[model samples]
Target: MPAVVVVGGQWGDEGKGRIVDLLARKARVVARYSAGNNAGHTIVNELGEFKLHLVPAGIFYPEKTCVIGNGVAIDPEVLLGEISQLASREIDTSKLAVSERAQVVMPWHRLIDRLDEERRGANAIGTTGKGIGPCFTDKVARRGIRIVDLMEPEDLLARMRSVVDYQNAVITGVYGEKPIDFDACFAQYQEYGQRLRPFVQDTQALITEALRSGEHVLLEGAQGSLLDLDHGTYEYVTSSVPSSTAGGATLGVGIGPTDVQRAIGVFKSYCTRVGNGPLPTELFGEIGDRLRDHGKEFGRGEYGTTTGRPRRIGW
Candidate 1:
């Protein structure tokens, strides 16, 4: 049983997607253990170029099982859109599975993320504004709505009403923004649930069974070690842990440490940090510009896969 985990060694954009995509050919199951649409994986193969947000990059392989683990916070709209986009490209997405225990990213979460970033102003953490941070916040605060909850209309409606009440208060009182419409939100998410229900399952059991059957499983992570909440630069890091050695992958996949046979850390020839953060080795001036241009690190190029913003490259 070969259970491998591929994690980013430096700040994200370390070609983990490409590595995972290549390695996925040997894997029976390839699962994304954490993060959400806030993290993007751009893959180019015989099928052309694709920028995957929520779904695992392994979906390209019709024979492999691709999973979104419970550690992820899923935005149903983004997920469905990605599925449709893949379908348009003639990729079979029927093998994709989502963890029912995963938390949901509501429309209000996106609003709150934007408002929060705006409030932070110059000191903003440079979030992707995809509601990832807020969704994790709700998860930690014990007020999150999971994929399973969405399957139950009445339960989901009741929980959404209470959550919206609290979220509206914060939006209005703290952020000074208008309250989200409960009815519209419920109806929209209700439909999302219907669309997503077919994909939901107990992913822990799924992966466990795969491991027990001596199948090769790959656990993929987003972001990077330097962006880990606990170990990275304070206030300028991602909210989740992106370290495979730190048990993030195991936790995401609901497995024990012994289950993982090895952890492969991916790094570029040089270092790069996306968004805002302390880049001790960041190159500036003409050299940086030349490097950026040579690497196509700006505008619809390599760096454009996720944010399009120029990556702060270094040694």
Candidate 2:
């Protein structure tokens, strides 16, 4: 009858996935409320190991509905690959749904991300270059393509044409890089559109109706409070605020704050941070190495599930 939220108490890589997976047993729905492919949640059971980037941990339960809420930025390529990977293992993803209002990650977003990082040079913020920041930028700029637009070819093309021209100009005229081939992007996206159409829907309504029916829900969060764009480490934070509090949880899922019945914060014995950031207490050199080797954790060791980089350790 209420939704529960799982948030990271530290700088992420905190085991929120396993907690959500365990909680999904009682939840009728599990929804991912923010971020994009840049976030990863791994789950291990009798079905072997899985590193999920976009899909919710609840997908392991066939009876539970998994929703990617409106606050997320989706890379169709990554989502499709995950869907295929799950299918290969005889896992059913038919219960997964994407919000019609969710933003789409375009080819140019990745290209711009790399260029922007290069421009930062020595000051580079160590982004994953997965098109996350750029996609969200376009979303805020009102130039983003939504799931509803993606499933409709004619409208998608009309939008892509203008956005591509503008982005290519930024690449060539601003960054002095080659333009993204419009035709190739269109062709690939057209295929993606068809493949993803089945999962696109008015997810806000779906979530609302589920709540109305007195079903329990789980709102899964990505990143951590320390990586939140508005509140985390400046210039090195994620595009979204992944905290489970007020604006953090409900704003993304299109729900009211009162809908959340609990907020579960996941923490570890030590602090771990991925990407570039100021870790004042971080161990370096041999000391860092020894602690890292000691980390044969959760089928992923102590490395980041998203970046595969050895997580910086601190206590």
Candidate 3:
């Protein structure tokens, strides 16, 4: 197939990482369509176990091109950090490409995310506080900073000055928190932009050309269908569409619907959920505990890759 999309059929953590890792060896291009560092995948291979957040799982294959699509919210710090970590492990990240249109996760986004969750208290959405939601919010609001914006320091400064002012108001006035400093944040993110400049590009065009040449492309979705913003449980879902059929996978990568030749759904033997939400089929009491023990579902043992929280298990 020229294009294949791999999505989680259940709630998040449906073992899509392993599936993607296995398929990536044959794929010429492995592209991540949605979400951000809030989602993670753990891949175990001969190179070792790798917990990937911003980068794609296909990074294990040195020759395959890995892309982070425009549909994703990227934290430059996280992306660079992941690249650095991979480099430290002797993994070649030269083939990595980031979408110039991808929204950049600012430091204030993380702060507001944590504060928002804190304000919710008992009703918190169990977010990873990595600024995924806030970043997407800015994207939709048309006030977001993109990877391309980072290359223009003056424009970045101007945009940040305006956005940070409003963000500060909400942070201090509404949330009763300390305001984020514009200058300090600009300086910090400016460095991140410079570091990330090389990898930013028109990823949509790259994927389109790759597909035209009959290069096998795999689009990876993070989280799961149950966590998808539209199809998932209200108020508890992640901020993005996590289904292959949702068109987010292909659309985010700047490809047409017809470009994908196949869609693969990855699921586990049973259902599992992280954070908080409704799990009608959830197993509790003794059986649940036994299942948890057997499956090693507890955090520390086998916690969530992003939040490290013990997953709620179901039959």
Best-fitting candidate, scored by lDDT = 2
Model 2: ten consecutive residues of lowest lDDT:
239-248
Q: What's the C-alpha lDDT at position 315 in model 1?
A: 83
lDDT, each prediction: 0.86, 0.86, 0.85
**lDDT against true structure, model 3:** 0.85
Per-residue alpha-carbon lDDT of model 1 for 1-315, expressed as tens digits?
A: 958998888888888899999999999999998888888878888878888888998999999999999999899999999999999888999999999999999988899999988988998888888898899889889899999989989989888876888999998999888899888989988999999988999999999999999999999888888888877787788875334333699988799989999989998888887778798888999877777778652234336355667778788
Give the per-residue lDDT of model 3 (tens digit) for 173-282: 99888888777888988898899988989999999999888899999888888787788887798886334334678777888888988888888888888888899999
Candidates in order: C-alpha RMSD to true structure: 1.7, 1.4, 1.8
What candidate 3 gets wrong by more than 4 Å, as runs, is 241-246, 296-301
Cand. 1 Cα-lDDT: 0.86
Candidate 1: where is the Cα deviation over 4 Å?
241-246, 297-304
Q: 267 in model 1: Cα distance from truth in Å? A: 0.4
Ranked by TM-score, the better of candidates 1 and 3 is 1
- Top TM-score prediction, candidate number: 2
Of the two candidates 1 and 2, the one with more favorable lDDT, higher being better, is 2
Compute each candidate's TM-score over C-alphas. Answer: 0.96, 0.97, 0.96
